[model samples]
Target: MVEGKGEAYLLIDVGHVLTHAAYIARVEGTARLAAVAEVTTTTAAEGGLLDGVRRATANLELLVGRQILDRAGEVRQPRDGDGHGVDGVVVTASLAPLLRVALVGLTCDFSLASAVRAATLPYVSLERTVSLEGPGDAWDAEDLEALVQEPPEVLVIVGGADGGPVAPIREMGETLSTAYSLLAASQRPAVVFAGNERACRPLEATFAGVVEVSAVANVRPSPEKENLGGLQGELAHLFYKRLGRSEGLRQLGTWAGSALRHDLDALARTLRFVACRHGLARGVLGVDAGGNGCRVLWVRPRGPALNWAAPFGLGSGLGALRQRRDPTAVVRWMCHPISWAEAWDRLSNIEVRPGGVPETEEDWDLQQAALREALGATWQGAVRAWAGYAEGQAVGEADMIVARGTSFTHARTPGQAALMLLDALQPTGLVRLALDWANLLPGLSGLAERDAQAAVQVYDNDALLELGTLVAPRGVLRPGSRALRVRLTVAGEERAELDVPAGSIRRLPLGVNERGRLELYPARGLDVGLGRRGRGGVVEVRGGALGIIIDARGRPLGLPKDEEARRAALEAWQREIEQA
Candidate 1:
């Protein structure tokens, strides 16, 4: 009757709970997963909420037997499902689709990159980033056309972290004022200045007549370190506007609960949680490749992409598509086989239900391809929209694949859909075998609700229809370099020689936690910051089904070309060799 040992535990992510996996374990054998459900509690309240969780439990008897039911028959099993028959319910207090944002920056350096990186995350969708450089660092009056034409939904004005260097930031302020002034009254933009707080008021008043302006703490308060964490929340607030108003997403938001943080945003927050639980960034990189985007993360005390542009993400140019109506150039990755007509229909459907699944494989394939067209077109269009100013300089396919668009419900397998993105953006060899979120929209929109961890767990263990994590790290990879051969090794096992292209990933074992940490190889550097341990050397990278990587991007990680070098590299990792 106990089903084995420990009582059943169900994580009732009252808010958008995607991957909240329920495990039943004793002080003995492995705690096997009893259920994994993706729940969305967007607009629902108390009663409606509890009912949702109850429905999620396929084991009805488990609930009745545990007396999780209350007076009016409400679920009170410790909202998080800590243990069966344990009076407490793991009712998480989370929300989704909080706000929409816009960014204004002085330059495209670390400051702006910080803003962009922040926007690329799960909780936020950077509406727009305003810069003085127009599109390039040397744009003329004509190049400023895009800034004038289509300003931004919100602006994150960033500069030299602190206010030390004022020239570039001031010029950017003037540029922002000028651009804001041009937009039609109804099309007025919003500005979130993260640069020198000293100048934000002036920029705010200067452009007050043009758009709504709000300012947050400087992302780069000082050059020695970068702070994009706050800005990430600010952007989530901005994106909330879009989520709240949209009928479809809004309804789903209700399921995810109020204030939704993007999947990436949730990951960022959880990263901190895991870090506090674990400690330090050895060589860690976390990736979440969803339908509309790709979020690559590595937690450090320095500058993260959220506060600036390290040229991160696979959906790099997706925002640029806001300028074009027919974004066909970049949406080619969804990879469904559909006709132009059906594609249009799917695109139309996607406008409202971005993750709608196609009933038939033919329809599914067509819609997926259409998704590529739509999102890709968005990427190209976003750049092209800016093309009015930055012209050819706009990062088309070059930006780290930051944004992606997909409707994954129709997916029959995990690798089938997500793997395409790995092939498209071509994750850097230094970091391979990232995650791909499907059907579980809450994972992307769970941050605002504070239910990210539960959501991530639900998706990783439950919605992961496909049970593989670290797919091999092969295919194309790039980070301003054209080198093939990534220095990948499994537990230092005779370092495997892989040849990834500019955009692709090899597969490996999936990881959950101690219960989820799939042990195939020793450790492929997928742990927290590349698995840095004190004597043990087990980098605690949390919540990835995919395996580890040996990235060589900016680090220029070595690759043994000749026999001697290969032997040397292998020897270097020989200490932590993978189990035979």
Candidate 2:
């Protein structure tokens, strides 16, 4: 794609449930998608992770008419003169086990919060958090015993300002040393010190022969400032180190060279890249509702990206979701009638068969309902950490909302997928909706490490499947009252004029890639992102599979508490979009 390089490139993603491969080639200075294939993950097979990759590549070879895999069943590094193989390979994976970590800090509100944020990757699980904010400086006997009994893969110690007192930090290190002494050398956790600069050397010396030690910049350099970049980077490095322990991953990494990346890391990087590339003032929000976990990322132009991941998803993570929320919480989003016991049984079946598909309409509804709640919970966590919103508020506005994972990609219809996101996120103002249908984001991000221009070209041209624009006004009015009025013009001709009522959603037809001009007049109390209530103006809009969606159901979308009424309302809304 760049000047004198080869044309064909291969990208692979090994997820918990599936393995995906995409073939893209540079053509006339533009990256174009040639083919895509997916197969069930083979990490547990005899061949391990490489089996899944080879099978996916074998499928790609059939579609592209090339010999991507040689006689030995390994990926061909460089393309032959006749273009029988690929020029480059990039791999991103989420099939590895979650990295277990323990956090030790001086206080709950400051150092502990920073450590939690730094370890919020989807592949990371916090096994324990010890907050030493009480009167006594000595470590509790129970805490030390717990560490020895269940040693984490990594131990993160964070506290103190740059020039603050080091006595508490040194005491913390002494307690850790006592705990590490009980475990064998192989069982001792790696230590990462991200606290006072003065304590770094002492902590390293304390854990010298006990475990691996790494020191990074202070997470809270001062009471007024929090610098998380250094800590987050160090955690990522540790994650790679842990992942590299797998022989399958080791072999795959060798093939990928420097282009290998963790799935969530790649997703976050791509989200930031998209925000900066388009100069989006409101930024971009990405929700990945995968099988193993759910991730929510909000990337703005200037500030640090806010990320939240929970081990609650549609498949293997369903048990965690059940434990976290009341079972009725999921049932509340379903339009169809089903008993709580029956719903629970079906969910249990999904847990047993993580890769199984819903065969009945009720089963499908249950899965979607759970997906909404999982996404909502993950989003709430991110919002609480973002510092931008007050309590009980919808997600802030964004220029674009990108949806990933099978929950969205495999929806029965585009409208169904759009509704799921709209209900969960409840985004306000103007925003473009898109779906990562091909699961290409992680691979594209991996490719970016080798050729930035080629990656950007592919992302801009073929990465996301746009799902039209969303115009949601924020306000409360009577259910049947006027919420907003819209006049749509396409190709200099008037197309439609309608009044959208409160507590209702309306979709206007504009076709894919069609441009339209909208003249909007919000109600006296409603604001459609035009600065004030009742303010009216004209703005350009684009269309996609679902056309233009006008949601006037208020900012914090409310559904009737009465089960019958809720079902009726949900059914009506679904019919509206399907008919459109």
Candidate 2 per-residue lDDT, tens place, 1-580, comes to 2223557889998888778999988778677888999887875555788888888999999998888888988777677888787778888887666678999999888877777777766557777988887877557778878887999988999998888887788777887887788778888888889898988887777776677678999988888888888888887888888778877787877764434678777887888888888787777888889787788777667555556677888888888888875857788899988887787788888876776778989888999998998888877777765554322324445799999988898899998999999999988888899999999987888777777777888887788888899999977888989999999999999998999999888988888779999999999998898888889899999898888999888977898989899999989888877655
Best by TM-score: 2
- C-alpha TM-scores of all predictions: 0.48, 0.88
Alpha carbon lDDT at 141, candidate 1: 59
Give a tens-digit lDDT track for model 1, residues 304-374.
32311211122222332323445333233323323444544544554444334467755655544433343
How high is the lDDT of residue 140 in model 1? 55
Model 2: residues with Cα > 4 Å off, grouped in runs? 1-4, 97-152, 159-166, 183-187, 217-230, 255-259, 324-327, 385-397, 491-493, 532-536
